[model samples]
Target chain A: MSSATTTAPESGHGHHHHNPEDRLALLKQIWMFSTDHKVIGIQFLVTTLLMLMVGGALALGVRWQLAFPWENMPFFGLLFPTEGGQISPEAYTMLFTMHATVMIFLVIIPVLAGAFGNFLIPLMIGADDMAFPILNALSYWFMWPAIFCFGASFFFGGGPGNGWTSYPVLSAVPEAAPGSGFAQFFWLMGVTLVGVSSMMGSVNYMTTIINMRAPGMTLFRMPLTIWGMFITAILQAFALPVLTAAGFMLVSDRMLGTCFFIPSGMVINNADPTVGGGQPLLWQHLFWFYSHPAVYIMLLPAMGMVSDMLACCCRKPIFGYKPMVYSMAAIAGLGFIVWGHHMFTSGMNPALGMTFMISTVMIALPSAVKVFNWIGTIWGGRPEFNTVFLNCVAFVSMFIVGGLSGIFMAAVPVDIYIHDTYFIVAHFHYVLFGATLFGVFGAVHFWFPKMFGRRMDETLGKWHFFLTFIGFNGTFFPMHLLGVAGMPRRYADPYLHPYLENLLPMNQFMTICACLMGFAQFILLFNFAYSLFKGQKAGMNPWLANGLEWVAPSPPGHGNFAAVPTVYRGPYEYSAPERDDDHWLQTEPPKSSPVPEPPKPEPTPDSAPVGEDTGSSS
Target chain B: MSEISHDTGSHAHDDTHHYVNYFLIFIALCICTGISVLFDVFKGGIPKSALVFGVMAVAVAKALFVMTYFMHLKFEGAWKFIILAPTAILAVGLMIALAPDMAMHYYTNDAPQVKWVGGEHAEEVAETEHSEHSEHQHEHGGH
Candidate 1:
């Protein structure tokens, strides 16, 4: 292995001497079906970005229906000429359902775990590549089949309209709704395959992080990004199997004459009575069992990434690094038990609801710890206030709003009122779109230099951030008021009710803000595209960060590094007093003496000042 | 300095192969399965709760035998517990959480018992097949 490291310098430059034909072939090989982790990460990035547009368009359709109920809509209204450009009630159901489906399965999960997780994990941990490179590539390819299933659902009679939860009886009985026939089947298949892809990726991540670390890159010394990815992998591996099982059972009930979620003597859509005695609530149990932990799976990686970004932009060590790790683990663990909170309105036992409520509230302890620690990290440092810093701050601010609203839902009595209201919708958007997506936006800017050897236009990036933040708040904040006003979610036309008719103006305001938010993303897409070719060339270590990845070349070649980097201290060693430079690199040997032993239990903040580890070692 | 070169290979390098009687474990698993089946077969004689408990216990024993011997978790490091414990806890917790609604049948009477009538309108269907039991009305009172 050391011999390969020695010969890497010559082989790395060999690509430069290739003829035009060979270069084209090499480009085709790398971009098309390459198993390089970096290429796979970019593949996920591009694919999920496209899906984000699709999901956003679906959401805009949903908003249009709400703001101007039964009115002829633009763009989507063209598809429904029979209704004079107005979306049908059934189409409205499919709109919100597919919007959530694409955002969760296709966009957020893939972009975080599949995109950033793949690109950062091996580099940050000083590994050459993922533990299973072929399996990693397979994970990205498997997403297409899932995407195909989801896309195919739309053609097969309007798509699954039972919402992303797909609670059965409606989902199981094919004749139950306009979209329940083959569209629901395809949706189930899509979910199952997405679970399969996620399972594969999580297994690969766990193995790579556990076994493939370079020397001195111990579990504790690894970056919080790695810790978040590692814990998220564990959550995915444990929770995804249940979703896959539930998906299969639903498919069987619809297609294979099984009754896992169907009960007897129930006639839906004028069909013959169902004969099976299987319970509908059973699906809720199995689904939420996986889905509850999945909320953290969507979140913890961003939490991890935001911690790293906040420390970097703030020029401070993350406040209580070990505590942050423990809290993340605690969140994942508690995530499993608190799933019953989602089932409070399903006529679950009061005793069970009480148990779930307690666990759900207890989960808030870890979340609040993370929020406070983030604020603490930003407290005393001379902050950079760049695009990265601004987005990280937004993530913290939005997470507080999301986390506080979640507490209300955790209470049985409160949840009973707001269970199916727009309030629930607002709470999750703040978490998923507000917190997680903002973290992703920050990360994309922070790591764009490393991903493409170029920096995104900071001015453009900040504009994207501000528009998104303002648009996001304007769009979702009013939903809390709407929910309190007794506006139910998934309603095609709430204006039909006299009590809710007064809220039409508020809904219209929110829809306009949503359109602004949706269009502001084009600035990001343009920045990404324009910057890829024309943006300023960012030398390695552009951010002047302390992590091991800063030691690698910008847009690192095939194996990610010329040689495996050996870590000395933790990743967040910014602004140490002993060093003249503000940043330190993990691979830098101590200037005066050999690297000291890792700190003992009572770890001091300024204990290890290895060297003036400033320039790019690559 | 700890000079660790990249070694993308198998981490498990236990050369010492422990002797395990796989045939015996297999036979034990089969016997456990047979016992559970027998309990189910004679369920009429046994009390319903005892039959269920006895069969589930037997099934658990079989699973343990498979995981310990066939899956070689017994020979694995203590990390096996770290990995398996949460899953075990969650599985049990899920059962505990599900038991009240699924097993207890607490609100079975209030559960909607819909009948199919050959009609398009819901009002006509409701009038013909009227079994709209209120959720609070407990048809079966004190246990």
Candidate 2:
């Protein structure tokens, strides 16, 4: 920040203060776009939701066939209908692979990092906008071509079938499946775009958080949200390049015939494949290097959001705030080490597996600390029954369910048995999709009033919650049972065996539940669109939640805080008996606020009323 | 001009983030690359001892870079640097844990069985399972 210390003091308000009269042309602006973090967040939000549905539907189709093998699915043939009725084996493989890609790269990564991280980082840190606005917009726009390439996979006769890991031989050879080599290319290209987008977002976040805290808002005084975003960006900065490099190698192998992942010797389609002298496990090494930390990338920010939301709603000073901070740092550090947990069954040595297992178990400790801190923050505070509060609680509950099951995978022997089983599916979906997505939902709802100047329908929100909670569990929970009964995964038709027959009924039940979960979002869609106009008009601080965000004008004016807001006390100042207000705002100075000189009697008719209270003094 | 407050009172030229530091990184990287390459060559002659020392050098250099730059300790606070120091050690420690399994695969009498395609040029190399396994059909090799 120093070389630039004398750089140029910003216009502070210049970037955001341009009048509407001087607006850029629509087409021109769309091409070059505004660098407003809010705009970038919305861009991420809309794109990711569209992809989520497309991916979710794919999951339903796969589940549909597995529950009832050989049945007549709407399109793409049968499950194995002797000839054709539901999904084909190739289609099944394609479904599984594409579903994972859409969920992780499109849904989780963007929604967590791109959407929430972009929207909140600047606002939370009290900056007018990101450090580099144009670059931020470029990073977001870059995602479009990447997504287009990914969606193109399905139409290329089929999508990637290498199970999202895209291991060589299976992913490298054209004969690996009926899919056109397009799937591999699409996966590589999509991930590359995602990596690029992540890198840009990371750099922007790091720079903004470091350079732009409001006066008196020192590092410790900054809210946990900023802390989470900062660490996530740091992880992304170092980790994403490895994945980008890995994706390029895979791209070259598929399109240009250079084998970075394929080992020496092998044949495909009765012809010797040119892919030789490449290590299959090396791809795993590089991919997991980015991706395992990527899991933390997805989780930590949401954890940060959930932490803020819980403390705000419960009106309590964040319990053990410093410990919570320490835990986040610990988790990010431990995350890089535990990638081997994913590779245990990839033929890693038993000693290495044991070491990974120990490291994996250690991660649970910091996570446990975070969970305890959340619960402690809310323990005795008068709880609000608002949508945001409930969702925060839901996030914690889901996280607990998600975290506890991770222990199963943390153990070496347990993972070996359940390595590629539905059990693994159940465990991660609970963590990644269930817990993390719930955190996102809570954040959106919590921030909706602040973003839109309108409060969401509580009734509809509640209905949305129950249906999602039940449906998510119903959909993922059965996989645990099926996995236990030794029903092998990745099969288009599991009913091929009589022993697995009992699980089909459960599978069908799960599929039906999954569809119900899909429909539950329609309530959300209704809530989102309907609330835009007809919902109750929310003034600033609708929930009376305490944080700097509430103190800013509703919908937050061009610059975040009206005046420079200095921090007074910690983030969660709930039920501070010393104050009359039940919830304490972060920008509100403590009990003995200030005793300014007794106001001088004003002259006639208020010439220009002088001596206003300039925000707060810490 | 916009007013962005700078607290230069506690600030000085941060040697770690200064442009000059880039040269240091470059020099360090060259040395690391040199060490790795040297070890690889020496392993051809004294494989065991060179392999151990070479990796150790690369690991130390990488740890230094991460500590000084990515973690931004050289330009920032000791507390942050202290927090940042261990992740590199953790990553390499994890890698070491996996080394033995990779070692076993390389050393075991077992060789990767290469399946014959189109029944051409299938021949055995010193009673190996892979090159001549047209009819042998090892169990683990198929999947």
Candidate 3:
């Protein structure tokens, strides 16, 4: 195929030729309530990045309390000077609770699906825009209400202290804790709105991916990123309604004198005993039902993007593409059944726990398949050691650690011993912070030129990655040992207990490392801001990726392509013997392809079509 | 590059519209609801398991009617099975998974049941509280 077909339209309307004032005005117009998928994706990216800082700050507070109990914290303690610059235990509870809340809801999930998914889906699939552009914008707009609700909760009764899971009785009864009343109500509202936002996005993605592929962009021929997104959309569509329903139920239980999750004869805070026959365990079942799959919802998109980046950086055809797709589907399928693993310690029956354990362990099979495929893709290839590649490698390495730790938690006996300990905390941080965030960082750099017309500074990016990698390991790895030493999570001060007193120094060390990790993010933020203005100009296809997105102009115009490109082969056709170039674009047609066929006239009653039925299948 | 001609005509507007009697389906759903309500109202005479099963069966029938007719799943292509089957399976699977703990209440004590203290016991409690309040008032008056 002629490259000129894709590049010709961009020549006349180059963004760089415009005056700075004109470009600024154009950007301002696009940034404000625009229905363009690219604008909405950037909107999500910037918003989530801000929320990531907020969540990170909350995490630092938790670390400070763990490291130096009851002593004056640097910035946070000043907010509570009435208690002699020390954070109250209730404040400590809120810190960790909101930390997880902001990280999972505002940062990881949105950054993956809302930011990268929205931006990449249309571009990668060779579509001009989403199937429903208005609905896509609405999805981005919906996130603000959730952010507002979560932010407002901090002012009202010190925010929801009952953890991110929001298990009811604590979440249901308003009088249960200081934050359980209006603050918890706000938290639930926030969660409900996030669900609404996600539901809208999932529907939009599903429709766009299924129906809006360009001519010849068949499902099998699409990149694994699209497949990952497609499967994640399906998972969200099926799973989110349950969580939405459960969230509303929890809300009702809190406000409307309903008791869906609150059992009868429960007294909280010397208050009157509750008088309803609702089961607390039911909440666990429902919450984990969505949240277990939610774990994959958080990771799978990153897994897909990492696969693409890995192949490009390694300059190899992805090893076992079909297997990768099948494995993602397998992971999503098994994710549902293994939710029971979360509820094993909640007094669920042993038989049910056993089934969950087995299912959870079985998820490892598909995950291992993906890991092997990624490794195979890396082997026997000339590799580029760019920032994107480093982060991709980190994602794989960290995910292995996270997935291995998860197996121990999947077993009934082992999990019972370490349930709610720092081990569970270590395991998920490895996955969420270690794997998903690193993958997202790689994706941001990889696609920065496509989003804008510039590349992020690689030198600063390397510094940021190394500091983060070292600091992240230093912070979280010892938490495994802390878990083994019986350091239960969500404690205000574990050192208060004699058995855990000696662990204080280790906690302090982790706290210092956490600070380092937290500060390293500033370098990233600075790099991003500086690069937006001063970074080197990148032409289209900076990474020389094989995906359809690479064919589009850097910072693609309103309708992404000058002409819609047709796919002739699968996305990962690197190093084909038929071509001298290492990478072959999906749209590139074969040199000697046959072109004799012409359209036949439609058959009528006088000239009936032979050998085929023309009737609709339905 | 030779542009491939897209067969957009294949997805042209179908003039043939399948009309379903939504009113009749709504009536069917109402009848199913009435049956469930009747079963629930007369649950005292029926065995608990039978009553639960009968009411649930009626509910399922109502859902089927709505899905097949009102939602036009019956007129949809075989892709409806692809979409609905996994959802149906997961829903049933979740229910089954939840049963061991939620339904059976295994190992743990049965869900605590709060008894309604009505008819006589409520009056006694009220009378005792009233006397206690009057005596306390009298003591306060004396003081």
Candidate 3 colliding pairs = none
| Candidate 2, superposed: residue stretches over 4 Å from native | A1-32, A75-85, A273-275, A591-618, B1-143
Cα error, residue A428 of model 3, in Å, equals 0.3
lDDT of 1 by residue, B1-143 (tens): 12243332222334444788999989988898889889978978999999989988998898889898788777776556566666676667777878898888767433233333333555776654454343224454422
Error of 2 at A311 (Å): 1.5
Compared with the true structure, all predictions reach lDDT values of 0.84, 0.73, 0.84
Q: Identify the CAPRI category of the predicted complex in candidate 1.
A: incorrect
Model with the higher TM-score, candidate 1 or 2: 1
How would the docking of model 3 be graded?
Answer: acceptable
What's model 2's lDDT at A299?
91
Candidate 2, residues B25-138, lDDT tens digits: the string is: 867877887888877777767668668876886988788786677656666544342234344454565456445653345433221333442133354344455535755565
- The numbered model that scores best in lDDT is 3
Candidate 1's C-alpha runs over 4 A off are: A1-31, A592-618, B1-14, B21-62, B110-143
DockQ of 1: 0.14
Q: Candidate 1: TM of chain A? A: 0.93
Docking class of 2: incorrect
lDDT of 3 by residue, A1-618 (tens): 234234322322244432345335546854689889988898899999999999999999999999999999889999899998999999999999999999999999999999999999999989999988989999999999999999888988667899999888888898888655788988989999999999999999988987688766766777888878877887788888899999999999988999889888888888988978898889888888889888999999999999999999988999999889888888888887889888778888889988989999999999999999999999987789999999999999999999999988988899988989999999999999999999999998999878877789999999999999999999999999999898999999897799999999999999999999999999999988887777777767777778888788777778887777777778888888887878877877656764422222333323321101111100
- DockQ ranking of the models: 3, 1, 2
